[model samples]
Target: MAEQTTEQTCPQCGLDMPVDAGYPVWCTGCEWNVAPELFVYGLGGTAARRRELAGRHSEGTFEELAREGTRGRRARLTASYVLSYALALMVHGLSFALLGAGVGLLVAGGGNPVAWAVGVPLVLLFLVLLPRFPRLGSRVPRLERADAPRLFGLIDEVAGEVGTRGVDVIVVDGRVNAGVHTYGLRQRVLHLGLGLWAVLTPQQKVALLGHELGHFAGGDTRHGSVVGSALYTLRLWVEVLRPERWNGRVARVLVALPLTPPHHAAQSVLSLLEKVSLRGFPRREYLADDLAAEVASTEGARDLMETLLHAARIDDELHRLAADLSGPHETLWAQLADRVAAVPPRERERLRRVSALEWHQQDATHPPTHLRVELLDRRGPSTPKVVLDRRTEKAVERELRPSARRLARTIAQER
Candidate 1:
């Protein structure tokens, strides 16, 4: 037989080369090697040329890469919460002080030094204490003995795989989703919803756990929490100082006669701050999903996405059945059973046979089913795509507008 030469091309560049030299055929033209998997998947032959062109054109900057690493909805929401609260407090304090002074002048005609003393001190105390008080000195409570060992071990194992410290784990007895939170330095805590534990498969569980870890790794937990706390307090002060017009006649009387407008405003501001903090809660979720992909495989991230979708479907059915029951206090378990029965017989059988171990909680602030599926579908080896459906985007906007308004009001009042 005559001797023959084998030729290969680089995936990054389009230069032809010898195949026998190595498994990863390098393109002499672009100086990039074709991934072995791409070759195995039958992109190795004539398709290799196409891949080379794709790789050459698909370049990204360091800044873009960094942004991808840290991108998370939760972190942004937390930041918004913090800012809104801080501004709310400032506005509420100023409003209260000015209003109190005005009222004191009108009532006592410059003879009420005591009113100024008390009012000023009260305002100062609120400014100094409100933002720091609620969130400070609070910790994620410990998990029970029965739950602690396995949960902690799993967290440690996942953290180890990602080259990071394991987060402190807690099991909250609620029908909600999981979250990772940081209070102070090295005080990371992972809270798992008992409902999630009931439904997720082992693989799905790990994926969800990994997702929470991603939040910590992305640096959203600790500093964001601190900022959120501060903002919450500030909002509280604003609410106390500037009660809303719709606060009803009784509330108006209370504010005008005893509490004063500033006090009412401060209370309103605080309530707004609390609500805004919740806004960050949702954005962190998207970031955690991205982190999950980075730490583990995209497959792992997909598992989490699927599990959440399933949980949501189950919860929605249960919620609808509960709404129909016409009782003040219907048992959730019974409602769930009724919901299960309402499904088609074939589907009901499948659900009935599902293990108790496969149920997740219902109250988590997870994005809807379609959105999660879309996100997972968009992920690949090279890069992950962010798919913000119109509904989620709209919800985000709706939540943010009120928060921004509160922050702006606080800023104006303070000035």
Candidate 2:
């Protein structure tokens, strides 16, 4: 195979490594890889056939279905955001407004202290009628840009490819998932699961990053925050006066009256709204998948989705590793790659086929891996040319090594 040339530079040590198409592209000095570069099996080769098969067993690729879903989601999201802020501001406004009226009435009453009676309702309204909203935070361990320049460098490049500003904070966590979190109006946080990263090929890793960054360009996280804040406020109001959590918690009898019929009604409405609000999420997920493919390649996207299909197996293996091995998180993690590699090619192929069997669940933000893969398969052929070395992988690993170890130990104790 002829070597593929890349305009890409090494994120760790900037160096140009250009080559002809067909082979993996490697750095001259550090040998850092540029993932998924060469052309390979792609939508151009398999889409029509796959779609034909999909139609026999699935709803088929209905463009109108996606369009309708997108339209519905936009309308709901706009209404939700407007209602959230409007209700929040209205409550605050009423609080101040009632306080103002109460003060005016008290002063007018003058020497007659009984005049304060006119302001009693207003005072009560000011203190008890308003809803309090909690500020959501990342709440995960953060990796600073200075400490992980190389990782951030690749991330920044991927963001550029996905047309995003990149996440403000990068957190390393235990879940085998990567996601973006935004607080209030802004403050985007990206969480990368160490377990997930440990298993991905260099090309698949790029696709994974692209998938996370794609959320920013897609504005899915922003939509989520609006719905989440609204639900949170309603939930808090509903729970505030519950009898069960009192005394041992905060004394429920004193607050029982505060949990009014109206609060209960709002809670019920929010519960229904929570399921209805994210209706378009599955479609947005497909769009993000598309963006990842666009930024990486069809092959990269396919590989990334394949990685998801193997998540259950990986998790089970990790659990077994924890139970069987008495070692730190890093040690368990170091063997993670080997465990994945040990999965026989025939079994992996069986998994790839099984991935297509996942059905879409109601209220799920993401469709099953099978459906996601089918959609991605439609994008034209693209593949990575080069892969990073173990040294480079270890360098990225060090960023979350401590956390991975801690989590591993925790898993062992839990077992």
Candidate 3:
């Protein structure tokens, strides 16, 4: 062998440099920038550049991307766990305090053991049952790959394209809706309602999957999942502590009685709390949609919006049919006639038209379809790079106010 020489060029300014000149063979000819680590990692050679281009050209390694995604997911879940514990502690303390105050009153009233026993159980109930109620121990269901291989492959391909992980895909057999969720450690799950699958064409399905991938890429699934879990726990606590199903007279009597007045008062306070918390759930849904849009393409967002609209129409029709079935009937035949009449001919025709449409539309817990479409159609990057405009910020702030208030109230009530 005479002499093996290597040729290298600066990727930035296209100036030639000799290889084996230590690291970062910066071209003296131009102000080109290259990280020395790239060379250290054996990614600086011509072959490496060609490989890089090839990797970029190809679909890329799904397994490598998924592994990275799993690492990110683990960090998010850890944070959620910490936050959940903190919130749980606050709720537990408040419940305990209320129970104590209620018991103290009963003690002053000739040391009533019956009242003590009743109060203790209520405390126990709040402690044991309240934290997990409403959204208790809900896990993202696992998707079987064998049943929907094509769908799973599509999901994996899309996820890889988006540089995210394919969440565990599940099929819910009904007319519900598709959703992506990140819940607990090592769990990112996507559920596609059978109704949605049945209705959507392959392209529409791809669009829906893209929209969901957007959710994962935008970190919406993790954020929303944690917030949703917290809300679930809080709602359950409120339900347990708050008075419900009690007659007005009974409630008044309970309120007036000094021995258990603290418990009644706590219950009253929680009723107000429940009313406030209910409003936040709707707002979070909107934020999640916005986040989803940021991750997916504008077309994906539009498709999602359309899907929601179609679902709403279908749901409305279903409700109408149900209403017709429940009407006052002269006989079985009359009931059948009523059911037939309940479905509006125009609505049925619309459903047929919607069904024939190229895209699949499914119901969502998001804003109205018109509003969503308007948002999606606006000319800009899917994810804004600049500071949000004042008007948009104000709208988001207004939407979040209720949740902020609930958080503040929870803090205050704990004190």
Candidate 4:
């Protein structure tokens, strides 16, 4: 039986509010305890400051987008955007210069021992750094058109509705997330994680597809080649420049003396790119959510957001099952499905309240879940552009079964 909700008086407002039992008590009138002072553990110094800046930037973006609406005119030529792109071009240019110099050294110093010694290392360095550029594609299990026609057809229908081209490839994995990314000269790949997909309703799955495809339609610059490649390069530079830990204090200081300045410089540029990209990402995410609402109906999109609230719980259960040596390997997904379905309403509401208090979002780039859900509520109901029927949904599930079993067994054995 479902638990009954009871009325409780708010201390500040003295208003009787209906709240589910065994959940956080907060006032609807005064909004008490909604954002209680959190006892955060490991936030201080540089990390704390970055967190503060990210939160402030994301919140500002949410408010601005919410006020102006997702369809509001977007200014593409902001100072931050220009500066970020300029830095990206500069980074790429420097990399090319290094590459050219390395090759030139090898060509000019043909057989000289000293020259070969110097040239070989430079050439090797270039080769070492080359893989980070234009990074594309993962090694996950790929699903071909013939393998799942219904699924691909559904994706095509969504792409049509969203005004984008269909994906070139679809890959399934064990992660509890899904995304769309470009690889190999703009070939789009859609990644579907069975951990999340298997439990979603058919319409929720449509919403997921709409949201991912919407990233393409929205022209997400952060994920685009220029900024994306630059971000990766800067990250690699940071890792390369980081000072090594030494046993002796003098040795550590010596290593730091040479590497610290360049390391800090690279980090500053990385932070700048991240800050600029953060400005664009929240708006793009909200726009994607808007597209998701359009394609899957407001109710479907809203429900999907609500489902995200329980993601941590789902992840925790997956980890617990993974760590259990005696757990049945064959029934991994089935056990997860049952556990998810058994999450009580009170716990769901508790998760919602926790999200509000923590200002939880999918990531730093995403707006808070509460804000996104509210934006959807403000947009009101939308008629779905596409719907997933039960038969087609079942067909897709059956098509995914082989990979699902393989992934499940892998997870089970990894313990």
Off by over 4 Å in 3: 1-89, 92-126, 133-142, 145-150, 160-164, 169-171, 182-189, 216-226, 242-297, 315-365, 379-415
Per-residue CA lDDT of model 1 for 1-415, tens digit only, reads 1122487554445566655321344443443432333323323344545433431211222123234643332344345655655655565455456656656554664557776666566555545544342322434345533444544655676776544677653535334367766544346666655445434444455667667776565554223545444554455545545545337788768654454655665566656655554444434545566566655557757655645544655656544544454432324433453443343332322222221112212234443333333354455542322222455434433433333333323323433
- Residues 209-243, model 2: lDDT tens digits: 88777776766633445544555556765665345
> Pick by TM-score: which candidate is best?
4
- In model 4, the worst 10-residue window by lDDT is 35-44
TM-score of 4: 0.76
- How does residue 295 of candidate 4 score in lDDT? 91
- In candidate 2 the C-alpha lDDT for residue 184 amounts to 56
Candidate 4 per-residue lDDT, tens place, 332-392, comes to: 7777777777665655665666565566788777878887888888778889999999999
Against the true structure, candidate 3 has what lDDT?
A: 0.44
Tell me the TM-score of each prediction against the true structure: 0.46, 0.68, 0.42, 0.76
Candidates ranked by TM-score: 4, 2, 1, 3
Q: lDDT: which is higher, 1 or 3?
A: 1
Clashing pairs in 4: none
RMSD each, Å: 18.8, 13.3, 23.4, 5.6
What tens digits encode model 3's per-residue C-alpha lDDT throughout 1-415? 1122476777766777654322234444542322332222222365344444432211122223223422112113334345444454565566567667666656664567777777666666545543332221435233456655544655676676555778664534334367776555345667655334434433445556665665566454223444445455555544444444354776746743432554455455444434433323223333334444444545555555555545654444433433443322212222322333344333333333333221222322333334345444552345311222345434433433333333323323433
Q: What do the candidate models score in CA lDDT, each in turn?
A: 0.47, 0.62, 0.44, 0.75
